[model samples]
Target: MKKIKTSPLLPQEFVVENISENEANIIAYPFEVGYAVSLAHPLRRFLLSSSQGYAPVAIKVEGAKHEFDSIRGMLEDISEFIINLKSIRFKLKNDETDAEVTYTFTGPKEIKGSDLSNEQVEIVTPDAFLATLNEDATLTFTLKIYQGIGFVPSEDIRDELDDGFIPLDAYFTPVRKATYEIDNVLVEDNPNFEKVIMNIVTDGQIGPVDAFKNALEVMYAQMAVFNSEISVAAPTTVERVDETPEIKKLMGRIEDLGLSARSFNCLDRSAVKFIGEIVMMSEADLKNVKNLGKKSYEEIVDKVAEYGFAVGADLSDEVVSAVKKKIEAE
Candidate 1:
């Protein structure tokens, strides 16, 4: 007879396996990663659409007619240069006015992002070319660099004056890239048990751990307000109720009510014994008894509603009116 080797069971947790340069791989054991995966989308969106950076917001030029030779090409070159600038992250040393800096560029060469740098601002991508000149062109112009979130137009940030203000849209997105992947790794001697690998990547500004933390913070904040709102709409009182064994069995198992695993687990053991009173209490009041969040309360409401009852259905018109009036007075 051959003996089977027993392996130690791994606890559910998150572990960073590798981090190289700008990317990192992490492992989360026995996690219902759908929750984490759902959060990843918002993290990426926040990184790309909400992160802060600096860019050129305004520009001015002189010493050339509207239709000078190769002026169109020069404008196109500048456009491409600005597009590249949008990708670079800038570090601001001191607060500066939105006031523009006047510079004379007699360019017979390529003008780059570094050329715009001053003592207060340092350009990370100095090699980026803003414009190229085939012939000598004298251009005296002001560059207005400012810090902001997302792509903000000059009109939205400052007064719209027709003072030769070339309104340029500024890009401040600091996130260069973000991606995540889920993989299943078989545990030793336990082919049936697997660990979930959640790999994440981001720009140097924000690391994977920080991003995940922020995402959870946002989700919890929203859930807190949402839970409060739905609870106030329905209030319940705790009272004894007589029920037949059949009715008790029908509501015995929280899972039988089509509640999610996460929400079902949040219910206290006492909840099973008080199912009758529970279904009659407002969801807001349930927070006083059951240790659950907004999602759990919502699930309970859905389950109760299916049986033609509500969390606060037992409240009389007089009680409901009083509660409403009290709430308004507050």
Candidate 2:
């Protein structure tokens, strides 16, 4: 069998080649075709179904019913107009709670998405068709746009929504394109394969880097749920598990201490394992950590006290004596 060589995946595997206003191109090298293919679907689905975007979800129409009335622009019933509204991309300029815009049209001409613009809302897909009208047709209505992840059906909309607004089926996904390619495949006569390249393209709302970050966060959150249920003996190389009541009381992530990411990132592994060390560390000792400053140190002090833990508080003397005796016996 002939031998084939492939580049090993290193730190610089993922590279962004180009970025545009609404799109980005990225390449991940030294990837296997099987893993790349597996990653492609979830990434694409997450980009298209999970990413947040804007869409018009409600509309109140005037002078229209099941059948076209005497009005000229009432080419279709209210149902058709609602369908068209769902397709229009609406960008909410105001807070999500306050998402209402009024569009009044005395249609002497064709009505389009662009004509629905208000100070609080702008139609992104401006060329979208609404309805055609003759000289005397008139239509006036208010639209409510919402920001949410994934597609939510009209019936699922809660009763708390304001009266006169009906939820419509809308897909607010901003991802216009999501595709992956596997390239640079090399095979030997014996069917041994070498390297493969995978490329990803994403819409501008989120670049490839942020998209991957979001996807990873989603994946990590999912794994965290299942990780608690797994039961097995860990290898001996793992750190000794602390089973004492005092140690159990200290268990938690750094965020449990109320420190933000900026300050938490500066803490070493040892300090994180013994969270009380955060309060025990002196100003001079903490200042030595990269990027940790007086302001953050003060914040940590205040937050620790809020949690009823004092700065520099140590283990009880009785506990220490018990530990000393146990160690001496050992």
Candidate 3:
């Protein structure tokens, strides 16, 4: 009969491959079964819905009272012109609040994003077409550029609009696309581990690598809401003193403990590098470390006991007594 392996493993590495300035592939490997999908789905949602960007939320065209109206000499009607405005991406240079941008063009000529005059805003898609005008005809318009996240319908901001301002559906997320795929990967002799391959594409306003990082940050912030302190009915507290001689000896490097790879990595990643630190942590605290399972926790407890120290024990008197006895024998 074959034995079953029950412990979980942390991903070995997270690598970002920049495919282009605005596209990237993020890879993480050696996750336990089903963990890849658990991580990738939420990240995909956050990347698509939480990224911030600027878009024209409202517009007022000269010679046009509403979207249904038409402007003379303009090749595109008011509705078509507004749709073109949605394609022009804006990047704010500073912390300025939302503001109105105006453009005036005379034809015979073609109008583009370059025709807009705004020092605080940069047109990322400057070559984007707006409309064309006939000879001696003039086109004028004002756009209310607003910074926001995800897709917001015009009706959501309708109450905030003033008279004659045509509300628009805003596409504010800079992430153009986000997707992920999972594949079976081998870890040691186990064939059930998985890997995640995520592809991200962003608009010119943000880089793909930056968008990936921001999505991770968003996921972290959302998870932090549930990272509250775990309360126990009777908590075991181990006070540590750095000045005592035996305690100082206990502060020796954790590497000397000869812990298993999984146990040692869990402690190292948790920043518990000293034997003193490990001795001070309760079983519950050790269990809280990412990927530290019950088996690894038991291994840590047994290894620490070999040194005549107990995890989460009141070591003030017991440690001093053990050190003195060992010194006398030496």
Instruction: Return the top candidate by lDDT.
Output: 3
Cα-based lDDT for every prediction: 0.55, 0.59, 0.80
Q: Rank the candidates by TM-score, best first.
A: 3, 2, 1
Give per-model TM-scores: 0.49, 0.55, 0.67
Roughly what TM-score does model 2 have, to 2 decimal places?
0.55
Model 1 C-alpha lDDT per residue in residues 87-172, reported as the tens digit of each score:
54455656653445676666576777678667766666676656675555555666576766678875685575345545567776
Candidate 1 clashes between residue pairs 3 or more apart in a chain or in different chains: 231-284, 235-282, 236-282, 281-311
Report the lDDT tens digits of candidate 2 across residue range 128-194.
Answer: 8887766777877776677777787766764646765656676666666667665554321122222
Candidate 3, residues 24-131: lDDT per residue as tens digits? 999988788899999999999999999888888898888888898998888889989888888888877787558787778889998887666378788878899988
Q: Which is better, 1 or 3, measured by TM-score?
A: 3
Give the range where candidate 2 is weakest over 10 consecutive residues by summed lDDT: 187-196
Error of 3 at 194 (Å): 1.2
Which is the leading candidate under TM-score?
Answer: 3
Off by over 4 Å in 1: 1-29, 63-89, 95-99, 153-162, 185-330
**Cα error, candidate 3, residue 310 (Å):** 40
- Candidate 3 least-lDDT 10 residues: 234-243
Ranking by lDDT: 3, 2, 1
